[model samples]
Target: MSQSPGILMMVIAFVLALGPLVFLHELGHYLAGRWFGVKAEVFSVGFGREIGGFTDKRGTRWKFGMLPLGGYVRFAGDMNPGSQPDPNWLALPAAERARTFQAKPLWQRAIIVAAGPIANFLVAIVILGAFAAAYGTITIPPVAGPIKAGTPAATAGLREGDRILSIGGREFDNFNDMAAFTSMRAGMRVEIDYVRDGQQARTETVIGQDVSKDRFGNEVRRGVLGIAAPAEIVRSTVPVWQAPIVGVERTFSLVGMMVDGLGQLIAGRVPVSELGGPMRIAKMSGESLSLGFESFVVFVALISINLGFINLLPVPMLDGGHLLFYAIEGVRRRPVEPQVMEWAFRGGLVAILALMVLVTFNDLGAFGVWRNLAGLIG
Candidate 1:
């Protein structure tokens, strides 16, 4: 673990890391809306009271806000910034209806809703592709070095020198991929395929959870297979033409890891306290910056993927929520009632707020705020 920077440095690092990614996400929605002939009322990089902005010729107001933690693109006829439909949209004259989001066909609407996450993925892929083209990747054979007694690997009959071939049918070309896959699957059963000497074998094992303190003293739960990688590592560089393909592979690997972690959290295998909010992100941003540019870029990619995935959750007040509603609309042959949308969005808002509070409390604890207060009382 590295020492976090000064408060000011951390703030700067957080803004630098999060702001652009948010802007890019909103940009995706804005562009898609424009392409589909839907009018955007505002393109904002944050929430709350507006700080500054200018309306474009197309009547889109581009602005910044006091809070830099999140952003949105308010399409025309949206009730608020959440993309909720406005009744006034339906009452508008026929000409005005042409540019409203609600007037668009279902498929076009789905595309606009999905574009934000797609943009984040695109950014990750491009950054990763650039890295691959520049430095290639360090490859390590997925050979087991040591097996800890009484652990999942030992119980599953894994031994030293067993070459890990795959997990859940996905083959690994590097130890790093295997490690990430295993770590994200705490308390989940996974099928492992490995080769020993002249024979290949398969085994089903329940991944074990290992609890450890993170750099900021927060309890972190990760899956452990109880096997270590061999000492040797190899750097394998691919041709420039292959960089993008390799980048896609790397991105998908991360996506799987995120999905597994979320599943573990939902299944109660990982505690909800493990959820980190803005302060944790800020600290990580500063620490990653200290590690050098390449590490920072990698961190950005992870966060980007996370942002994309989070938005796709089927909770209201998020893009995914809207998509869920659209899915029902597709099946029902009509929009969900506005009253239903309102209730769903309200519930989602409450859930999002509750999560924010939990993570913020965890962040304060991680930053030693409670300790400082105790010292003051003493």
Candidate 2:
């Protein structure tokens, strides 16, 4: 069926977003592998035959391909570009097989597989740091700024200095996230968990209109409980001694959150619709950029971390899949049967492809493509 301009924009935006993200992710693998004396034979930005490329000094043929969906790094002795070991590699001299991935120490192998996602997280941190250094940080503490005496919040017993803990079941880390939530809807009643006098607290708030005329000469309506945040960050940055600590902690926490989110998704507590494909990400980045360069960079960083986390999930035909085999070998003292592993990998490819289709459509619907198409048709 024919679509609308909005739908087309979303598609274009999505491809643009995914292209770089996928390329960088695979680049991480390529660089890290090469650094460790592992030979990367090919570095492809996308799948299928090479559309454009040049050979590097180490015989690594770097190329761009027709498909922008995915990419791979082909290591020496690999069965394919993804670093899977070849039978011929095993048949070679013991010294030769020693250079293959299957011959590497489990620790080294894990590091190589992990480097891809690690690169993503690193990208996020650098982007965030650069943005933070440039634009400074924003701080919105939970302490209520002020509630107009005649407003519903004041009348409803909401008071200033009340520390917000959670809203709509999501824990509020700071006032910034709270503000983001509040800005989404107007006149929505919400149960807010908070702290009163540094003790346990609970609140039910009926959001009222915080009326204002927006910059576009239009009345912009948004949810407001008449809360205000202090406009400052104190310029928080990792000290030289603490950079790694803070970065690692943040990375760990993000991983935990991603895992928790996945668990919730699998349990049906959170819908798969919450998942964002390239289209959603691009739209988000564009919006964030409109807000500020810092916001755009930070959003990209966050997306990079998300990309890293998802790729590392223990699914067959993924880096995690190879790690899984190594893990099994460590425990059982033998590699998984080649035939079984091959079949499992085939299934994995199928699963991954199916998921891509679902997410793409989800992205279209998310951007309201169908509605726009309907409007066009009408």
Candidate 3:
């Protein structure tokens, strides 16, 4: 087993991986707000007290905060980092009020709020595309190479040389797609379609699962089909012109996986202990860094996608929450009542804080902090 990276390395890796992504996310919001004539009062990476900063020519105070978890852009007329509207800003003269975020048209406000997450998605796409362009894409046919006896695939009547057509109604483009899909569906029964000797057939089997730990000692649980990849592999160099298209397709594929994972979590098919916070991210970042530069860059891209997807969740205090509010206002042709919005935001904040605590606790447990403490006490 490989040893985990030291604590200092983990912290440095976390900062390196998260800092630029957070900055880009906020930059997306700031640029969009400025485009609509909104004056950005502050552009800070992270939260809480300002550690170091300077005012830009546009009067935007660019700063770093004490906490290095996430970032925000406070536009004019915003009461706080959450972008709540300030009633006091309403008293501003016409010229100044016009430059406030809240004073912008409803559509513009929605765009500004959405830009942050969109930026993260774009970053993932660009990175993935660049990788494809550089090293090309490798694909394997979704044909069973060897079926281990008594495994899910074997039990499902699958045989060697059988070509997989689909699983759980999703068509397979490559063996990797099939493997990735099955890996996340552990213990769930799903329909599998394949062709044997030019004849199509279908069967259902419960996906087998394996639980193990990575080199860093983090637990990993994955569904196993007990069918190996075919011997033949194909690699194709992606054209520079088509890289972006490949990027978009790959990005959406990842988003789909995220949706599937979230659904599993909600359905209780997966343990809530799988939820991770900053500590898990830091560990993964350090481990990826130790592997090599390419692995580290890919890890960053994956995190970028996660950041984008999570922000789009309809939970309050997220970019998605703001979009939800804007959607309601659009239909009603009026903003949600201030008191109602306030209460909703408060509730959202509480929910967010609770989730953070839960994930942090899970992280500590995964790291053996609780176990070590118990050993010492005993």
Candidate 4:
């Protein structure tokens, strides 16, 4: 295995990669709020105590916080960074109320909230489009090469030159998609459909497992199909004008995969240990940086898509949570009772915190932090 990047390099890479993405996310909210004539009280990158900032002419205090995990934009009449309306919003002077976020129409509020995620998606599209324009899109045929004896594929009567059609009902456009689908399903039984010599066949087999160690000595496990097929490289030069279209298509494709992965996790088919947090991201960022500029850029685009997708989940204390409330208000033709909103936000906060703790614990285990500490103690 290759050596891991230095600790300092990992920290630097984490900051360099996540900082701009967070800023852009918050900027989307800020710009949309401003467009709706809502006054932004604070535009902050990161969380917790402010490190340094300056008040802009529009009274938006642009600041960096001590914790670099995430960020937010607090608009006028917001009770907190979560964008909850102030309880006393109606009591504000007429002029002040007009410039407050709560005073905006429901549709405008929804747009402002949704803009953050949309911005993230746009970032992914632009980066991917640039790559497609420069290097073209690549695709590989989903054909089995060599089936290892005694493995699941071999046991299921799979043979070389079989064209894979789908696994577990999910059709694949290419071999990469098939590989991705299998990699997350270690130890899970899956039905495979394929065409062999112009005849269709189906087989059920458990995905095989491969366990190894990264440079950091952390155990890595992945599902394999026991096929030793080298990916047939097929590159198509995308016209510069059509690059964005390719990017958009690929972006949606990735989102679909993510949805499937999420469903798998929820159904208990994928282990919770597979989930990760900031530390995992930092590790991957450093590793990608070590690989090359192109690898790092791709990593950034993937993370951007993740950030967008996650923020759109209808959980409280997030942009999606806010949008959810706006949606409710739109249907009801009035805001939800303040008490109900408060409890919902509280529940959302608890959920978000719990997720953070869970993913962080998973990260610690993945990095062998707990095991190393036990070694020191023992």
Predicted structure 1: lDDT:
0.87
Worst 10-residue lDDT window for candidate 1 reads 213-222
Candidate whose TM-score is highest? 3
Q: What lDDT tens digits, residue by residue, belong to model 1 across residues 167-241? A: 867798778888877776787788999999979999989999898875544566788999988887888887889
How does each model score on TM-score?
0.89, 0.74, 0.97, 0.95
Global Cα lDDT for candidate 4: 0.89
Model 4 lowest lDDT segment of ten? 226-235
Residue 373 Cα positional deviation in candidate 3, in Å, after optimal superposition = 3.1
Point out the worst 10-residue segment of candidate 3 by lDDT: 80-89
**Model 4 agreement with the true structure over 314-365: per-residue lDDT tens digits:** 8887888888888888899988887788899889888988999999999998
lDDT of 2 at 5: 36
Query: Candidate 2: lDDT over CA atoms?
Result: 0.69
lDDT of each: 0.87, 0.69, 0.91, 0.89
Q: On residues 1-378, what C-alpha lDDT tens digit does candidate 2 reach at each position?
A: 322234454455556556777788888887767666777778888888789999978688989988776788877787852355786876888765665666777778778888888788887766655554454445567667677776555755767777778876778777766765665445667787767787867767676666565332223445677776744334565455455555555566666667756765686544566666656666665555555555555666677888888888778878788778779878988778877787878888899888888888877876668779999999
Residue 220 local lDDT, model 1: 65
Task: Please state the error at residue 246 of candidate 3 in Å.
Answer: 1.1
- lDDT score, candidate 3, position 179: 92
Which candidate model has the greater lDDT, 1 or 4? 4
Ranking by lDDT: 3, 4, 1, 2
The residue-by-residue lDDT of candidate 3 on 90-190, one tens digit each, is 89999999999988999999999999999999999999999999999998999999999989998898999999999989899799889988887889889
Best by the lDDT measure: 3
Error at 314, model 3, angstroms: 1.0
